[model samples]
Target chain A: MASFKQIHKEFVAALLVPSAPIPKGLVALKKPNITSRFAVYRNNVIVGLIAALKSNFPICFALVGDEFFKALAVDFIRKNPPTSPMLFEYGDEFAFFISQYSPADQLPYLADIARLEIMWRNAYHAIDAKPLDIAKIQQIDAKEHSNLTFKTHPSAAILKSNWPIYSIWQGHEDNDMVDIDLEVKQAILICRPNVDVLIANIDPAACIFYSAIMNGRTLGNAYEKAIKQDQNFDFNYCFGQLFALGLITDIAAEN
Target chain B: MSNFRLKKIPNLAGVGLKAQHYKTILQEKPKLGWFEVHPENYMGAGGPPHKYLTAIRELYPISLHGVGMSLGGPSERLDPEHLRLFKALKDRYEPWLISEHLAWSTHEGKFFNDLLPLPYTEETLNHLANHVDEMQSYMGKQVLIENPSAYLAYESSPYAETEFLDQLVKRTGCGLLLDVNNIFVSANNQGYDAYDYLDAYPVEHVEEIHLGGHSVELIEDDDLGIGKLLIDDHSSAVIDDVWDIYKKLIAKTGPKPSLIEWDGDIPEWPVLFNEAKIADGFMKKHVSTKVKS
Candidate 1:
């Protein structure tokens, strides 16, 4: 028999690569060849990880349907198996994998949908933070509003996409996306104020505004960017939505 | 950590906790011995998993059953980061009992996410002993090591599976989990007698027992030949054969904390709770008869 390390190296190598011969010295009772037996472990790894991916990216699985999703997932699993034992931490790059996958090219919005799903999952599992109280906004003086920089909640995220990711995801979610134009661009917000994660479509300008706030820009700066992007950018409404949802954790005046 | 009071899990049947059943378990607060969870599932920073687990923990004694520790891997030592996370979870949850598998899922920095088998050689035993010892010391308590269900045996393995587990207990002073279904699955898959394996197992050191279901698969290979393989899928109800063996073991050893594990194709809460109730029935029947006798 080979050394313990050598056996593991060979065993793991075979487990990952389907074509890799069964590691030496593996045997089933009364049978010299153990490929069928050994394939159980192989199948378990592939199938188990694929199941984890399926649970993690339900939208992608639903959008592409089962067969395509499984093929796509298998390819992704072969390339980027989980580095950690925590299955939730697996498949962060799955959306990128879908973007590169050729078959999913026909459904161009698929990758962004994957991104939305990832965001929703992240928001669901992200660290809990106490959302800023609505009264805190009332405490802020109008004169200091320009210097006000906002802190986003731990579970807050903004996704901007060329495809109608929000409608596509919401349609699948509610199962009623009426004649969504694939050419339309969409921006989405994912936030968990308390227990449930909330996903909703947001204005493109609000996307830029939220992005700027998350990047530590002052309220004045974020509003300027949002207004420049679209004159109709309603700072009042965006700020109200952010405050209501508890997406903003803190507001500070930049001296 | 030592100052924290460890609530002993009762000698009744428990079920593996699932996220889907959190609301029901919380609202209903069903009569159960305890609940078990994979520590890996709760390793997330914060979320519904933690929230629900916290609420449930207040109601029942929860045991941390880890599947990712790779205690039997050939690494020179266990993964320190994984150990740290395990320690953190143990601290936060303060579970009454903790257990890990005898299989290796991690090798060379990549996790396969499956409990892969190991060859039971002297060298492998020594490595596993060290890993178990390291885990016990890190956790400041005895951790239970479960026997793996095997599909293939190593040609070079010199030690019988029971002998290997017994030696591990003697070497590290850790306890055994005594997975009854795994014993049945492995015995059938490897052409050994489950009864004989049970007789040989170090049941005195067993702190817990796991009763779970397994699926049967037909392996069709022109080269390897045809055979019926039992996969420890844990998706269905526990077979009567497995239950009989479980009864036999408990009949001899008295009642131990047995968990009904159903990880795949999870059924409704009632189905899972009823499985636990069945195991509870076995525990009651055997232990009462033993006492009466």
Candidate 2:
């Protein structure tokens, strides 16, 4: 009799790698057709996992065509099986895997694109929060603004990329034919003001400021960092832009 | 609210609610007896999933159908994180039923993301029953154990699948979800008689049922040349053969709260509702007539 742990381990191993040896007690219906039944399970498991990944990373699939994406997915699944039962969270390490994947090394920006897609998925499913009311912020005194620590909204994502990922993503959207340029760097911000996801280009200074806020920096310190990066960093314009996008939700007193 | 505490779900048909049809269903308030959701989808802290679920719960009964519990495993241990989230959702939604698959999903701490089958044996049954008992104790309510749509069977199983399920329910006092499509798929895959399996099932313990579509694939075999394999893809329309079997099972078991599951490539809301309506019409015609006579 196989222990529960041994049986489960063997079952999963058989499902993951079809060629893995089945446990001692497991039987073949006839003489030498040992791998027959296990092959069915192995196909189902791999196909299901790949389908889940494709659903979660549709944009990633679009970037890399289906054949290449599926091949990469098979390797990725074998290397990094899911840590959690929640399928929505199964591909957390996919971007990291893509980074080290040698076959995909020709597309240096593929990993970052995967990261962007993951962020979009995260923002889509993040906890819902009411964006800061513009009228409420206007009610506060201008003098107290520097002392206030602004908290970013739950649906806010700030990303910086050396490739024109926004164009690549948008081109894929309408099935538009556009040549990919290898020399463009883009900083993008994605926010959910209401229900629709809105993506926009952001300046490097504002990206730094938002990134700082995302990392728990005080508003004044983030502003200082933003200005240090770019001498002509428009604090008022960037602040208004962030507020308009509903990225700032909570405000705390700077200690 | 009525004081009637249902020991078993009434034999009425229901629909699996999707986000695309949330507003339409809520606004129209269709005469659905119940709704089922995959608990993992709503495991987040606060979001639209919960919001829509809250609104829907006020109108109809709900069932938290879990897909990731890995109930049929070697160890009798339940995932604490999954349990906590499920408990929280149950508390907030106050669903009428909770259920999970009779299959394992994880091994060595790595989730395979599919409901892998288990060999039916005394050891596996004991392990699964204890897990079911633990889950019921933690949730403070009985759960329905649904039969999985398996693609293959292990050659080393000592007990029949139905017998394993019977032992599980006997030990844990848990009910059965009795997915008829799954029975069809598994029977076809394993070259067993689906009708005989259904007839032998402990129908009294069944509280709910599931009906879904499956896709067939032809695999080459050395001796058999090509063999037909039924895959429970849940991506297309329900087949006539499965529906016929479902009607026969319903006739025998009486009306149970059944659900029409179309998970992948889900069609327009009306198409799914029409399918539900078909099942609803059958239940009303058969079960209600039996009650009246």
The TM-score leader among the candidates is 1
lDDT of 2: 0.80
What candidate 2 gets wrong by more than 4 Å, as runs, is A22-36, A174-180, A212-221, B1-10, B23-28, B220-225, B288-293
> Interface RMSD for each candidate model?
1.9, 2.9
Backbone collision count in every prediction? 0, 3
Q: Using DockQ, give the best candidate's number.
A: 1
lDDT of 2 by residue, B1-293 (tens): 32223333446778787888999988899876788888888886555676787777777778889888888755558888878888887777777899998998877577876787788878788888889998999999999999988655666788888888898999999999999899888787666788999988988898888999888888554555577767787887778888888888888888788899998788888888888888888877886778888
* Model 1, span A1-255: residue lDDT tens: 798899888998898688998888877666633777888899999999999999998888887788988899889998998989999878889989889999887988888888888888889889998898878877867787778887889999989899988888878879887798888898988899789898768988998988898899988898999999999999999888887777898875554
Error of 1 at A81 (Å): 1.1
lDDT (0-100) at residue A145 of candidate 2? 65
- Model 1 misplaced regions, further than 4 Å: B1-5, B220-226
Shift in Å, residue A75, candidate 1? 1.2
Per-residue accuracy of model 2 over A78-149 as CA lDDT, tens digit each: 998887777776788899999999989898888888888888777766787888776766788877666667
Please give the lDDT score at residue A90 for candidate 1: 86
